[model samples]
Target: MTRIRREVLTLPAAELGPDNPLPALRPLDEVHRIDGRERTDLPADMARQLGHEPLRSLLPARVRDGYGRTRAPRALDALVIENDRLRATVLPGLGGRIVSLVHLPTGRELLYRNPVFQPADFALNGAWYSGGIEWNIGATGHTTLSCEPLHAARVPAPDGGEMLRLWEWERLRDLPFQVDLWLPEGSGFLYAGVRIRNPHERPAPVYWWSNIAVPEDRRVLVPAEEAWHFGYERRLSRVPVPSYDGIDRTYPLNSRYAADYFYEVPDGRRRWIAALDADGHGLVQTSTDVLRGRKLFVWGSGPGGRRWQQWLTAPGTGGYCEIQAGLARTQLEHVPLPAQSEVSWLEAYGPLDTPSTGEWTDVVGAAEQRLAAALPRARVDEAYAAWKPYADTEPGTALAAGSGWGALEVLRTGLELPGTPFPESTLGAAQEPWRQLLRTGVLPEPRPGRPPGPTPVSPPWRDLLETAPATAHTEYHLGVAQWHAGDRAQAVRSWERALRRAPEPWPPLRCLAVADQEAGHHERAAERYADAFRDLCRDGHDDDGTRTAAVAALGRETLEALLRVRRTAQARSVWERLPAAVRLRGRFRLLLAELLLAEGRRAEARAVFDAGFEVADLREGAEDVGRLWNRLTDEPLPARYDFRMRPDTG
Candidate 1:
């Protein structure tokens, strides 16, 4: 019979608990799952909303939905199971986190087991820990309950093996997911099967990821040539993997670089990845189907990156890297499960004796011997044949070059799928035949600049706003509709209400500020814009794209209004939060200099204006800055001519 042991552990709370300091809930909207109104895709803009906004709700719901501190210095239990081939340790106290994996034959721990329990403010739920394999379900980021305890059970294996099960009933979303891990007799690898169940009648959002932490020994083999990153803006761009920084990233990285990247595997048959030291000993992770996308998180192993390295690792424990595999594609573009549906996946992990050469073929051969897969080799050929129909389509070709996400397949089939972010300025509805030229062609376009999106028909603006006042998105649309409907006062109230519901609800705040700016209330507009930007810094976590979008939407108008009224100090406060990309513009730089002078930062302002842009060549945007310059110092604007229209128009 298989022998599985459980151990209890006591530990201190993370020195830095969740970054969320608020334990008190405000009166925010609680959008209950209306029986017939199963909300799926929340529009592109709402889909982009994340971080602390979803954590705290004003209405009563699941307590866990409100971000809080993890109980510390408490009793915890860990489960241990081993065979002649290997041993595994799971901390049920920490969401059944697999803290250690050891190869019995070599007697070496393959996983980077953290010396002590340490959590951080690194998850969507606001608390996460480093080390071990984190079974991530639902949308991307850490699982909601990763830092919380999970329900654990021992499945008595009748087949000469031991199985351990860890499961969770997710908060708010009401999704239930379970993972079963087993080590069958005569098998050298550990097997795990995960099932995420959606019992609701309406389709629900779903995302899955397996994040495994490995020793930072600088020797790993991921058979990928290219990888893409959507980053904060969700702009898809690809770069060479392994050699991203001129060095094969397969090895340990140096310096202060920190990034999140997604690698798309073209050869569907190759679904396994391995990491080994010079001594031919390490760990291997493989899956049944093609792991469409893999994510690599690396914090440079040097003095420069030490700050972040320390942030992620506990004291005395060496730095570790995450080798994550996502279902179908990167979690940036999550998909929704059909109503009353469920999905299951399998992963095989075990010891690897990779050759020192690190050749792809050699790794594959090793996996074939030590790995047990549920799928047959014939599946690879079948996938190729199915993909043939998209051979001539733009998405297919772009995918071949490793430049797109899972949505490209939807584009190829002409299906209107939810969850994919709408097209940005760079991706307007591509003109048909020409659009057929790439994977980026199918991004749905956002409602150009804001205007209530045709005023909800069935639910109507009043229904959603009155029924779900805590919903930032609902209020945002209503504000726009109210403005267009000539109820400017109501629009202002609606937007302000949205801001209070969620600290940064940038869209509504930007719209409100715009209204004030247009009304010639420059001072009031500057104050609101500045406050919104400040909230972005305080409560906006992992929201680079949101911050960028907010500033881009209102920075110019806000700063212009402030400068026009000589609210230099207020202008400077807002200016600092603008993204580097937008602040570097000549017109913005000129406004910044005038403001700097107002604050008595004359030297800095003079340098900024002097070196910013030649006034002679600034004919297009010279007027605003020129006027500000004259008002501030009684000086004429730089010499510039406008003999013709702008370059873009020409």
Candidate 2:
């Protein structure tokens, strides 16, 4: 028999403080633009889906970069689901990640469970952590709910045992999804059944990837003779599997830089990938055919890559590589899920036996044989069939609660979602005003001295705002909704109207500056940004982490806008106004170096680099440190600061 119980896993972690109170008005610039001209060899269907429905902006959700580098011991809520052969620990508050999967017989841990909880800037919105089996939903990068919570409850499993179900409304795509985890009696494999439902009458583009981290020393094996190699150079090219660039790529440490290898699994093959140790024991992940893609990601044996590995966890912790499964042939593509339809699939993770001491073909062949005998294709298909009936079973005995956004959506749209219930009892302070708006026809006014509530830009919310009474609150919300809909002119007008009666002009003023910047009016945008920063400073705020993060976010943009228009003095003023703690951050330090360079203070800029700082949330392909170092002197960029992803074109 299987049992599910609540527990706590404590680790030294930085508090994921309050979310930054600023709307993400600008488009996400970190999509890592791919070069299409070099990918002519891609299959017709894969290429077609690759260019379809890309993300522009991550509106509605706010930035979650408030976490600091300082860490303290803290206890995190978790759920433990165990049977006779295996045990699995899940963190409901952290995107339902399976933090630990252990085999009882050998006492071996299957996943690379990270020892620390360090939030980095990796998600579509912000703040993603490394390790564990993360269920990424919504977009190409990490899911926005990476460091957020998901509703959890215990439900009846197909074998009459209990399973843990995690559900949430993914805000980016406006879809409801659920993941059910269970370990059948005396079974060695842990099963995860996932379903994403599109309740609206319109089609939605969906992306999902189950990211599993294992020790990098192991050799990974997938059923493929070739792979689509996507390197940091932003180029996607095909190459022979196991061996590429005169070395065996199956060994994670063989490469010299970070890269992705999307295995080209042939049709009718069992969709699976495995990472086994040298002595024939490690983790293996297999899923239904619907989840077709398998990929291997490695932080290769380079200085930049090693630095990233250390930055993600404790210094002494060993590095790990990721073996992922997804819906498309590559992570860049999005599969279309039609309206009123749901995509569900079952996945299993367990131990495998295969020796890495032999040749590549021999090793993979032995692993395939072991997998076939342990959990055959028919068994997987039978599990999926059995799980389908339990997929809609209503959850019982709530174990954890996620955000109230799902409940609010259900209230507004009257959509009856079975199995995953968004009951009104889960609504909180954040959803109060929206609840009022849905009940009445107008949005409520903001409380005095507090920041405005989050702006919902969905069509239904936008329609409600358009018919509401004309107040500063409504006008500002309307402007955000209009901007998301691509109504630039109307958005500007609404912001102007908001300024007329806005007690706090900073919010609307900042928005107007974004609009001006987008329209290429740099001078006007700089002036408005300066004004907004001044207004925000004048209106006193607490010295809490949230306020400091908000101020720092605004200050960074203010300096950038001013610098763009050659308003050097204004940029200096804004930079000086930032709190001492904010100026100490790696990002702000880099910006200060830029400002010094702009002012011809070459020595000061060099000194800033010599001090040695680490950008906690540096993008995957960013060359900021390298580029800045080059501008300062002709000396080779320091190994510590060298994060250039792609080879130099020149």
lDDT of each: 0.54, 0.88
Worst 10 residues of 1 by lDDT: 394-403
Poorest stretch of ten by lDDT in candidate 2: 641-650
lDDT of 2: 0.88
| Number of clashing residue pairs, candidate 2 | 0
Report model 2's TM-score to 2 decimal places: 0.97
lDDT of 1 by residue, 316-423 (tens): 767777777877455554556788777666676777774634455465455455433433334333423432222212210000011122122224334332211112
Question: Which has the greatest lDDT?
Answer: 2
List model 2 lDDT by residue over 353-442, tens digit each: 767667777777788889999999899899999999999999999999999999999999899999999999999988999899888887
| TM-score of model number 1 | 0.53
Model 2, runs deviating above 4 Å: 36-41, 543-546
RMSD from true fold, candidate 1: 17.4
**TM of each candidate vs. truth:** 0.53, 0.97
